[model samples]
Target: MFDWRELLLRNQPQASQTDDTTLKMLEEQLLDLLPPIVSALNAIANLPIEPTWFQSEIAQKFKLMLEGVEQQYLVAWNHVRNAQIQKLEEEYRIWYQAQLRSDKSLYRTYCQWQDLLIQQHAQGWFSWILLGLKEHPFPASELKKGHSFAPETELLLAEFFRCAKPLIQTDTYAVLKNFYSFQAIFTHQSPFLPQLVQGISNSSEKEISEKLEDNEFVEAAKIFWDILIVEN
Candidate 1:
C-alpha cells in the first residue's frame, strides 16, 4: 500500500521558504497549469491501464499529476512570465462567479467533474490514488486567506451548497460535496476515502457512499491505518 502521508508531505509547499512574491508567482503558475493538467487527466482516465504500466515511465503521471503541477509551478514561470497572473486569477474568479448564477453552466461543470471521477473509478484508482489527489490539502501558507491558490481552490470547490445547488439529486451528491468542501484547505489529511473502501467487495459510487455513512464499515481497518501512517 502507498503511504498517503508521503504524498501529503510531498504535496506541501515549501511555504517557509516562499516569500509573498514567489508565492504569488507559484500560484499564477498553477492557475496556468491546472487546465491542461485537468485535460491530461481526462485523457488518461478513458484508457485501459494495466497495473504494471503505472509503475514506470510516466505511467505514474496520472497519480503524480498534482505533484507535477506543484513542482512545475514552483520551478519556472516561463510560460506566463510576462503575463499578469494575479489579474488572470481575479478574472477567473469573476467568470466563475458568473457561472454560479447559471444553473446550466454550474451543472455542466459538475458533470465534467463527475464524469472524470467516474471514468477514473473504472480504472480501480478511485479509493487509493485518485481520491487522495481530490482531498489531499496544501499548506496554510500555500492556501493563505484569499490569495495565492486560495481563491482558485475556493472558486473551484469553496461553497458546495451554492456551486452545487442544482447538483443535489441523490445521496451521492451529499457524500461527494463533503469530500470536495472548501474547508479542506485548512487541513492536511483525508484518509476518510480509504476508510470507506474497507470491506468493500466491489466498488461503485453507490457502494462507496454506503460504506462512507456506515461507521462500522471502517472498524476492521483501524489498525491497518495506524500502521500505514506510522510506516510512511
Candidate 2:
C-alpha cells in the first residue's frame, strides 16, 4: 500500500503570507494533491482479492488518510476561493460603472446631434411633422446634407461604437443581460432603483460576466442572489 501521509507531507508546501498569490498557489497545489491517493486506491483494486487482516488494516489506514487530507484541503481551498471571488466582485463593480458612464455619454451625444440637426434644418411646421414621425425621426439622406454637424456627429458615433465593442463582448455584459432579462422583476411597482442598486452591490460582477459570455445561466441566479440579496 502507498504511504498516503508521507505523500501528503512530501507534496505540501511551507506556509506563506496570506494574499491572492498565496491563495492561487494553494489552489494549484490542491488540484494535484489527491491524485496520488487515487492512484494508490486503483493499485489496491487491481490486486488479487485477499481477505488477509494486514491488507484490511492497510486499506482502513488509506481511507482515514484520504478523508483527513480531503477535509484539510477543502477548508484551505474554500478560504482562497472566497477571497478570490470577492476580489473579482470588486473589479466587476468598477467595470460596470465605467460601462454605464460610457453608454450614457454616447446617448447624450446622439441626442444632442439630433436636436441640433432639427433646429438648423427643419422649418416650423416641417419640424413638427418630423417630430410626429418618431419612428423615422431622422431625415432620409441627412448624412448627404454636406453639413459639418453631420460629419462631426458621425465621427462621434463611430468612435463611441468602436470603444463600446470590446465592452459588449465581455462577461460583465452577460450579468447585465441577465439582470435585465426579467423586466417584471424590477419594473413598475417593484422599486427599480433600489433593487438595481442592491443587485449591483451584491453581484460578483466578474464571475457573472464570465458565466454570461459563456451562455451559462444555470448558476447565474445564485450568483446574482449572492450579490444582490445575500451580500446586501
Candidate 3:
C-alpha cells in the first residue's frame, strides 16, 4: 500500500533549509507523489477482482492526499514568494477545483470501463443462448412471470444469475443519457452503428416505459448494452 503520510514526512522541510530551497523541495514532492499514486492505482485495477468499495475509497484518499500536498506547497510559496495571502489562496482554490474535476472525470471513466466489462460478459451469455448451447440461461426468478425452463436449465440459470445479479439492473435511460452527453462532446467519434443512435433518438419515453412495464427485461438489457458498447 502507498503511504501518503510517509511520503509527506519524507519530504518535510529541514530546519536549516533556505526559503527557496524549501519551496523547490515542496514542488518536487508534489511532482513525485503523482507517479506513485498512479502506479498503485493501476496495480489495484489489475487485480482479478476488487472489493466493490475499493476504487471509491482509494479515490477519496488520493484526493485528500493531493489536497494536503497542495496546502504544503502553498505554505512554502507564501514564505518564499511574498504574494498576497488572499490572492494566493484564491489562485490555489481555482487550481484545486480544476484538478478535482480532472480526478473525478478519470474516476467516472474507470467506472464506465468496469460497466463495459460486465456488459461484455453478459453479452457472451446472450450469444451462448442464441447458439442453443444453453436453453434459457437466465434465472426463472428474474424472467417474465410466465416463463419457465427444465430443471437442469434452471440449475444452470440460477448459477449464472448468481454471478451476474449485480450487473442485471435496468439502465436503459441512464445509458442513453450518458451516450448522448458523450456524443455531444466527441462528435467525431466513431459509433458502433449510426443507425442505432438514430433509432434511440427516435424512441419515445412511452415505448421505453411499456418495455419496462411488460417485463421485457432481456430487450432492455440489450438496449443498454448496445448503448454502452457504441459509446465506448
Candidate 4:
C-alpha cells in the first residue's frame, strides 16, 4: 500500500527548513522528476527484472531512475516544510465545486461529496493544498468555516432537479428526482438495495459516461436539446 501520508510525513523534516518561495519552485521541479522515477519503479516491480538480461547502458539507466526518485523526494520534502494549511482548504473547496458540476450522475455526485467530507476530517494532502491557496488568512474562527468542505444542502438537490429537467424523460422525472433527494444516505461504503440501486444506477452511468467521454460536450448537450425539438 502506497500511503501518501507516510511518504509525506517521513519527508517533512527536509521541507520545514526550506524557504517558502523555494517551496513552489521545488514542487514544480519535482513534478517533472516523478515520471522517470515512476517508470523505473514500474519496470523493476513488474519482474522478473533480470539486471543481467539488460545491456550495461540499460541497467545504468534503471539505476539513474532510482536516483531521480530519491532526488524528487528531497524536493517533496521542501514542499511539506513550506506547506500552508489555509491554501489547501481553498483548493479543496474549488476542486469540490468543480467536481460537483462535472459529475453528471447522481451516484458520482453523492460519492464525490461524501469523499470530500471524509478527506476534510482526515487532514489529507489535498486538504492542505486547499488551505495553502487561501489568499487572505483569516482568524482561527474563520478557519473553521473555511476548512469545512461538507456537501451542500437539499436545496442543491432542488437545483440539480431544475437543471436536469429537460435532459431526463418527464415520465420518469419524479422517480429520478426522488433518488437525488436521498443523497445524504446513499454511501459508497454500504451495499444499496439491489433493485433501487440497479434501476437508477444503470441509466445514469451509461448516459453520464457517454456524455463525459465524448470530447464534444457542447455537441452532446445539443443532441439533448434536439430531443426536446423532436418531442415538441
Candidate 5:
C-alpha cells in the first residue's frame, strides 16, 4: 500500500538550484530516502545478539519493509549495521568507564565477548552477498554504472551507502575502506555453503571517501556497491 515515490518525496524540501548547484541540489532530494530504511533498521534491532537472532517473524516484517530487494543482501546489510551498533556501544561504554575511573579488570571479560560477538555477527555479510549474486547475477548492463547521468539511480545509491557505511570501518580520511568481515566467512567456523561459490574470497575493500563533495562520495559508493552486489 506504500508508494515509494511518496516515501521518497515526503517532507523533502526543494532547494534553489544554481548552475553550480547540481549535486548539492541532488543530495537534498536524496535526503528523504532514509525514512523507510531507518525505520526497518530500528524495528529488528530489539533482538539479543546471537547466531539465531534473525527470526522468521522478524525476517517477514523486514521483508515487507524492503519488498523489492533480494533477501540475502538485506540480511547482509542488517548484520553489518548490527555489528557497527555493537562496536559503537562498546566504545561508548569504555569511554563512560574511563570517566568513572573504573577498574579495567571489571569489564575485561565483557569487552572480550563484545569483540567476538561483533565479529560473529558480521561474518556472514559477503557470504550472503555471494549466495545472492549466485542466485541472481546482476544484469550485465548495470555493472560499474555511474549515477552522474541518472538522478534516480544517484538518489538510490546515496541512500544505500548512507545505510551501509555505519557498519563498515573507515580510515582517518573518512573513507569506508576495511571489510574484514571477509575474514570471518572464510574461517573454519563459518563457511560459504554454495557448491560452486563464486565470490571474492579475500578481503574486499573500497576507496570511497566521504571527505569529497556529498554527491561525489555517493557516486564513488555507486561503483562500490555495483562491484559488491553485481560484480561476482
Candidate 6:
C-alpha cells in the first residue's frame, strides 16, 4: 500500500503561486470533461454483439470522444503557444534593460512571465497524464518506482482499468486474440472481434495528434475485465 501523497510529493518541487494557478486550471478543465468522456465510454461498454448494432454504437461513441479530445487539446495548445510568444518578448525586454544595472521592476516582470511559461508546460504535462490515465493500464508495483512520477501514472491507469473492466465478456477472447495478433502465420481465417474493437479505439482518437489509443492499453483493459470476470 503505497501512500499516494508521499509518492506524488516526495522530491517534487513545490509549485509557486502562478504555477499552482495554471495547474488548477488544467485540473479543472480535465475534471469538467471527465464526465462526458466517461459517459461515452460507458455507452461503449453496453454495445451489443450484433455486427450492425455494434458498429453503429461504436461509431457514435468514438466520434463523440474524438471530437472532445481534439477540442480540448487544441485549446490548450493555443494557450501554450501564445504564452511562448509573450515569454520571449518579456525576456528580450528584460535583457535590454539589464545593461542599465538597475530596473528591479523590469526584472520582477520578466520573472513573472517566465513563470507563466513554466506553468503552461506543466499544463501540457497534465494533458498527457489525463489521456494516458484514460488509455493505459499499469500494475501496482510499477506505480511505486523510487523517486518518480511513474507511480502517479500507474495509479491512474490502475484505477481506470478497475472501472472499465466490468463491461467486456471473457468469451470475446478467442476472437480478440485473432483480430489483434496480426503476426499469426497460418491464420487465413482469423476472427474479426479484435479487429472490431481496435477499429473502435482507433476512431476514438483519430483527430487527436497524440495517440491515446495504444493497443497495449486496449489489451490491458480487456485483460483486466477478463481477470475480474474469472475471479468472480
- Which residue runs of candidate 1 sit more than 4 Å off their true CA positions? 1-20, 23-25, 28-83, 106-210, 214-232
Residues 29-94, model 4: lDDT tens digits: 444434433444343322212223322344355556345445545444545533543344344345
lDDT for model 1:
0.39
lDDT order of candidates, top first? 3, 2, 1, 4, 5, 6
RMSD (CA, Å), candidate 3 to true, equals 17.1
Candidate 2 wrongly placed segments (more than 4 Å):
1-24, 46-51, 54-57, 81-232
Model 1: lowest-lDDT 10 consecutive positions? 219-228
Give me the runs in candidate 6 sitting further than 4 Å from their true place: 1-18, 42-46, 49-52, 56-65, 80-232
Q: In angstroms, how far off is 82's CA in candidate 3?
A: 12
The sequence of per-residue lDDT tens digits that candidate 2 reaches over residues 65-92 is 4566455543443454656545544553
lDDT of 2: 0.40
The candidate that wins on TM-score is: 5
lDDT of each: 0.39, 0.40, 0.43, 0.37, 0.37, 0.36
Give Cα distance to truth, residue 213, candidate 3, Å: 28
lDDT of 3 by residue, 164-207 (tens): 44343465444444333333322344544445445554364345
Q: What TM-score fits each model?
A: 0.24, 0.22, 0.25, 0.23, 0.26, 0.23
TM-score between candidate 1 and the true structure: 0.24
Which ten-residue region of model 5 has the weakest summed lDDT?
172-181
Pairs with backbone N, CA or C atoms under 3 Å apart (clashes), candidate 1: none
Cα error, residue 43 of model 4, in Å, equals: 3.4
lDDT of 5 by residue, 122-225 (tens): 33432333332232333324433433324433433353344344344433112222221322222222322341123332233323544233435466555554
| 36-130 per-residue lDDT for model 1 (tens digits) | 44554443443322333332333255546345434443343333442554554455456545544665552234445444443433123233233
- Would you give me the overall lDDT of model 5? 0.37
**Candidate 4 positional error at 102, Å:** 44
